[model samples]
Target: MESSLLLIQLLNGLQLGILLFLLSAGLTLTFGIMDFVNLAHGSLYMLGAFLCASLTLYSGSFVLAVLLALPLTALAGFALEKIVVRHLYERNHLDHVLATFGLILCLDTLAHLIWGPAGIAIPLPDTLNGQVELLTGVVVPTFRLLIIGTGLLAALGLYLLVNHTRIGMLIRAGASNRTMVGALGVDISTLFSGVFALGAALAGLAGMLVAPIAEASIGMGNDIIITTFVVIIIGGIGSMKGAFLAALLIGLIDTLGRSFLDDLFKLLMSTEAAETAAPAVSAMLVYLLMAAVLAVRPQGLFPPLSR
Candidate 1:
């Protein structure tokens, strides 16, 4: 019974990690390549979830909503870059933070105005609402398995896009030296827009996938975005590979710790004491890991080769 329960928790952790990777990948990429500190990235994620939820409700089709939301999210991202983010690119990080923070406030206000103050629940599609039996007497949700697959596929697609494509080469060059890349007759502005849009799309994808599982709510972005930051920091600020691995590590640690820490503590201490300490310890695991990593390497688990 314990072993089967452990397996389920492990899969849950993997699903969470995958979602974090989806969100963190874009953040690390945008920050790494453009040096743009977008506090509003989470706002974009919230908007994506709202859009998807609304679309699914109205259209009565989750697939259609997802297909539509991706392009819409990308377009919204492009517009944001072209209008507001472009001006902040030449500014300092502090300036970037301030501007984007204001944007976040604006987005939250707009979301409340549009969607009201309540959270919306996205129903799982009929096909994905079932469970899959993995081993004898061990069952996992189909949607969670899909999430794991989606995350792996997104990681692979991102790898190919960044490494095997022309724009990707430009992204690499830009990360190393933006001025030189621009001097080589490359249109840096257009490239930045593309990168930003792509990042937004990835965040949106993460938001959409999570909506059915965890209901879409205002300020949800702010909550999860902090964890995503932890993932990127632990993984490496600008390394997608680092983000992927770090997210999985953090996710598994968090999930499993929350599940079993009290049990471990119970063996060593009184039941009441274990209960009191478990939640705090579980919450601190990621930050503790981050601090330890920084104390040793200081550059994260896998710092980008370029930056």
Candidate 2:
């Protein structure tokens, strides 16, 4: 039974990990291909949640809300790329960070103004609200399973899109040498817009999926943005494959660490010490994993070509 409980927790970790990968995959691609550091990526996620919530309330359908929000969010991304992000591309990382940080502030304020300060609760359709019994007799929420399935599908789709399409070839070329791609007469601006839009759409999809589970609120993106950054760093900047693996690893470590770290600590230390240390230690596990990875690989698990 205890082992079964552990298995359930592992599945939960995987679910969370896959969602993180969906968000991080787009983020890493935007950075890798366009060299654009967008801290406001989380804003797109927030927008998706809000849009889905509003649309679901109005349309009375989660599927329709998601469908509408995807393109809208993609447009929002394209607008940001054209209106604000384009100027920051040639600037240093610090400038990009500042500009994107400002965008975050603007977005959060706008979300608050539009959605009001209160958090919105997304209602899960009855069909997706229950629990399912797995092979080991462990019951897990159906909504979580849906999230896991959607995330995996998105990851697989992105893999094929980036590795097997002409656009994918262009993205690869841009990642390795943006200047050279432009020199070769590629319309780099169009590529940038497409990449940014795709990234935003992914973030929005993640937000919409998670909204039924987590509250949609102003400033909700802040914590998630930090988590996404950790996923990218651990996975390797600009590497979608790395992001997927690292996100899953981090998710499993975080979930399992939270579940079992206290017990493990009690075995090695006093109960008081274990209580004091467990939370902090569990929170640090992903960072520790990242540090370990960097110590060995330096650049990341899969560094994109520097030039």
Candidate 3:
């Protein structure tokens, strides 16, 4: 395998992992603390992309669009929690799944109505649309680098927010034992609402960042939502640290497998056989890893430490 190609693939894998981390960070919090299973989380992602796309077009500034879209996505999350999700919190996971599944359809249709059926493409300025060379013969898109940086910053911010601040203390407490936190005079309802909104914003950030690379289409979140769930599951359900590391691992595995598996397979079998099997196996790599992890450590590679 060529070294340059390998490096490029490695970077691509890192980018994918960053996106997964962005989506999963907030989700793990919501899932771990509220015990809420929100299938509609992906809808927030789609909503963010579309919102950013529209705002970018109107303002002629991609950066400004993202800034504006974040609060809107958060507000959307807050409203959903207040109007719908809060009611279902007392119900079981099955109910959460069914309700959120219905919510997916509702949000999708709403997006379709407002944005129309076609995907909206976001335009980047020349400064970001160009390419940069990390080294001789190793050039990558400038926007991709921006994505990596933005995601890492977001992750760092989340770490500080969850570990250093007072709310972080509350969040950690809530994750460990929400009932105890509630009994201690903390307003569980407010805490849950804030968490859900935060999760939505994070998911939205993922969507906004990706909109330029891939047009923001209706139901775009449907596919990614599944992968995001796999990520959180592979990481411990409520562990931020688990989610970050696991996201990167899955990202590298999926990206590298797709890029290099065919070459490896060719060495082991007939070219035609390798060509066919490579695609199938590459697609299944993430699932296979998840299965292996589940078999050995059902709690995940980095289960959250108990308080």
**What stretches of model 3 exceed 4 Å from their correct place?**
none
Per-model lDDT: 0.91, 0.90, 0.94
TM-score of each: 0.98, 0.97, 0.98
The TM-score of candidate 2 is 0.97
C-alpha positional error of residue 217 in candidate 3 after TM-score superposition, expressed in Å: 0.5
Candidate 2 residue-pair clash tally: 0
Winner by lDDT between candidate 2 and candidate 1: 1
The best candidate by lDDT is 3
Deviation in Å, model 1, residue 227 alpha carbon: 0.7
Candidate 2 C-alpha lDDT tens digits along 116-186: 99989988789999989887679999999899998889988898988999999999899999999999999
Q: Residue 236 in model 1: shift from native, Å?
A: 1.5
Q: For residue 66, give model 3's deviation from the true position in Å.
A: 0.4
Candidate 1, backbone clash total: 0
The TM-score between candidate 3 and the true structure equals: 0.98
